[model samples]
Target: MSNVYIVEDDPVIAGAVADHLATWQMQSRCAKDFEHILEEVEEYQPDIILLDIKLPYYNGFYWCMEIRKTSKVPIIFISSADDNMNIVMAMNIGADDFISKPFDLQVLTAKIQAVLRRSYGTALSIHKLECGKVELNLDTTTASVDGSQMELTKNEFLILKTLMEHAGSVVSRETIMERLWGNDEFVDDNTLTVNMTRIRRKMEAAGVKDFIVTKRGLGYIVGE
Candidate 1:
């Protein structure tokens, strides 16, 4: 499922947005610890973020810029500050879209869907997977960890995507090779091993430790 993070501090508005998003089969979490919003976002690794202006610690613009340093995930600003200047500033600060408060839920949902499609291609059904602090963008074929992003080769991206999709499950090497070969890549055992090693090195260099764990004869997994 697509994950969305709601950074609105208002409990009522946040809860309402979360509920409406749930109806659309999107998983959402409202921010509770505003003090460490960025850390929470890194952990959540949302596909999209619904941010609000005039927040407690820092405004949406600040957080949006902060998130931009680490990720290119789509962010849509939702707030009562509907002035042209505010909207312009939000866009300038890396916001994908903006919506004024008291807006129709259907309209908001449609906007969210559009942004998701625009940012991550037309496949709104595919989810961006996260393992610990690392987030793999399936659409972009890229991986981000601790604010640093690395472009993954097609094979490498597929391998990480498969493992992150199965998270704790032991994805057999045969299963991964099948996926790569199905993409017309013609991957052999050695090629798969090479790709996995490269992925691990890139991830570790980006400050992701122990991201992919080898299960000896089994396969590989993101977590224990």
Candidate 2:
């Protein structure tokens, strides 16, 4: 059973989410010390995290950043602050996905399951793949170019993996979207764009140049 750590301030919502997760055969632990959620997260070492934006002390963004410093555990933000800016900010800060407030429990469950499947499931047959001089470590969800390694969030890793697996061929936007979110119906198109931009930025920072080529009106290619 996958363990989920919920850092929601609202007791009612946290309780509801925990209960729903229980029905899905998942174990969850709620954060009681909002001021020191990082400690709780460390102690729990959950497979995934459900973070809320509005909290008692520092807020979810701060915790997300702190957690990203050492861990690549998938985080999904549940917040009423679901504006485009907030969503984009969350993604930029390393969140795997964002679900707005007043959401259906079933939808939330599905999202959680999808994220877990991607993060933990053995979808890739090989442990690593290479694009030019850059190497993607599937087991670690990180890439190294010229010996400089960069970590990737779940979305970034998935996008890069798809492109590398089909190296030299443009993987269409729709195909990538389907591979990332299981379908395009539930996710915004721009989210994929944001993930792609971040992945390219990370690659560039790690000494990789022009690693992903964008073919206008088609998709992206890793090589050739």
Candidate 3:
């Protein structure tokens, strides 16, 4: 199931989006902590985001800029600010689409499905990964927790992908090294450590606590 992250602060609208998506068997997460919107995005790492322009603290444009620095995942702006300037600004900042507030769920769902099919379905694959309630962005190599986005390096993305793919299994260091070695000109051991550390830091910031745990001589495990 594809996860949709809703950044709207209004409880009613957020609930409506979640309910609408659920009918299609599509899962969605609403941002509960407005104070840390990006953090929520990082945890829920939805396949796409339904962002509101007017928000607490910094507005949607600010968050959109922050998200652009990390992932190419689609972002659709939602707000009462329906003027052309807002729409133009949204598009200029890399927003995939814009929908004014009080939208019809059916229409919104159509748009969501269309965007998802265009952005991902055509790729000939589907994947789902999460750290607690947070979703991992397989396409952009990032994670969204509590509406916050966390950027992952190429190697860090790989390590997280490896561990996420085999959640409970202890991925051996040698196995990890082999995977890294096959990439480009072969990433060294030190490079792997750096990537792991970076990924762990990103994970920690998402409120994941201990995301990757060392298994002594064996290797690493994602789920404890």
Q: Per-model C-alpha lDDT, please?
A: 0.85, 0.86, 0.78
lDDT score at residue 21, model 3, on the 0-100 scale = 66
Better of 1 and 2 by lDDT: 2
TM-score against native, each model: 0.56, 0.55, 0.54
Model 1 lDDT per residue over 1-224, tens place: 78999999889999878876764557999998997889999999999999999899888888999999999999999999999999999999899999999889768888888898888786674547787888876545578887688998867877887788788899999888876674455555698888999998998788777888989999998866
Model 3: per-residue lDDT, tens digit, 1-224? 78889888898889978975664456888887877877777777788999999888889999999888888878999888999999999999999899887788767877776788788875523444775656776545567777688886656766776777678889998777665454355555677777888877877877877878989989999866
Model 2 per-residue lDDT tens digits across residues 1-224: 67999999889999989976764457899999998888888899998999999998798999999999999999999999999999999999999999999999878987887898789785422357888888887546688887778888868877888888899998999988886666449688999899999988887787778889899999999888
Candidate 2: minimum summed lDDT over ten consecutive residues — where? 120-129
Q: What is the lDDT of residue 1 in candidate 2?
A: 66
Model 3 scores worst on lDDT over the 10 consecutive residues at 179-188
